[model samples]
Target: MNRNTPTSSKPVIAIREADYGRLTALAQVTIDKDLAVGDELMAELERATVIVGEVAACRTIQMGSTTTYKTGTSEPRTVTLVYPGEADIEANRISVLTPIGVALLGLSKGQSISWIARDGTTHTLKVVSVGK
Candidate 1:
């Protein structure tokens, strides 16, 4: 991704009222501080384009080359951000609250972004495409 690339000018996609409500509830339950990044993220969730992918309908999503999260206390493992409710990562389906998921939200096909991981690592990811 080019550092000089221009930010998107397309109108933000609007999420459904039910989806927005669900995201807001999740944020309130999981987020720590009222001013934390999660707070900001939840506020923007209403404008995100929800993507979903499965084995039958794969959508490539860039993920941290080296990063992991707690999953049954076995070992930290890398995670891939795919559409919500799909793409199992470490046996746990990732939610958009995840760093990569949040970053990828609302992006169109071929759009690339350099995002900071939860562990402070930076990664470049492109939206290859989205599917049902």
Candidate 2:
């Protein structure tokens, strides 16, 4: 069987055209943060392939998508990606400006990304499923 490789091997990503504008603004928000991951988020946005929302894959991750993902070998977690204004750690709603959020945007099911955390520790998250 042929399995999709980790996201590290596929540097390109697709974002719904419907989301492009909002996400672009959100990306700017990250840049304003001036944090280490800010530039990385902007880079991801700049390189994304914008697709029309109606034709976009249902499995593609996006804002408001409730996704199940596994970080490293740990148990998979479910979180709803949201705008920064709606972020609440206890509610499991992560902000678009966060590191995990940046890595998760535009990814699809079965894909995964390895990135560095704010603490400089490395982490890998694989997309198990995406739901609205």
Candidate 3:
């Protein structure tokens, strides 16, 4: 889907089944520390289409995938989606437990998602590219 495509109430997202269990567990673990983002991640996972195997050829974003994305009209940023323990903002490694990370997960290149921040601000994030 390109920028011109009309995004739905929530765009379709696909997640590898192999990552589902671990992701869900991660969300659960973070609930106490960050209820809002954790809940958001769980909700996103609940709505995702789980694929059983590899989708290496697809441009879908997954854990460990390096992606370039832009929020609203901001400049594009490259980040590696990683687990909380591995997250390092200075290195551009984002934790799936964060709002932007949850928003990026499962999205394919060219697709965009609107998410609410902890401070109650809404933002649109578009995936420019995805690389494993």
| Predicted structure with the largest lDDT when compared to the true one | 3
Can you write out model 2's per-residue Cα lDDT over 1-132, one digit (the tens) per residue? Answer: 101233346556777777778878766776676655567666776777878755474668777888999997799999998888999999999987777887888888888777666676778898999888
Looking at model 1, residue 92 earns an lDDT score of 44
Off by over 4 Å in 3: 1-8, 32-34, 56-58
Ranking by lDDT: 3, 2, 1
Q: Quote the RMSD, in angstroms, for model 1.
A: 9.2
TM-score per prediction, in order, is: 0.50, 0.85, 0.87
lDDT of 3 by residue, 44-89 (tens): 8878889876754256899899999999778999999999889999
State the weakest 10-residue window (summed lDDT) of model 2.
1-10
Which residue pairs overlap in candidate 1's backbone? none
Candidate 1 lDDT over residue span 1-132, tens digit each: 212113353234334333456666766665655424475356456445554433322332322112233223345434454444565667544556666566554444455555556676766655545433
Error of 1 at 24 (Å): 1.7
Q: Where is the poorest 10-residue window by lDDT in model 3?
A: 1-10
lDDT of 1 at 70: 29
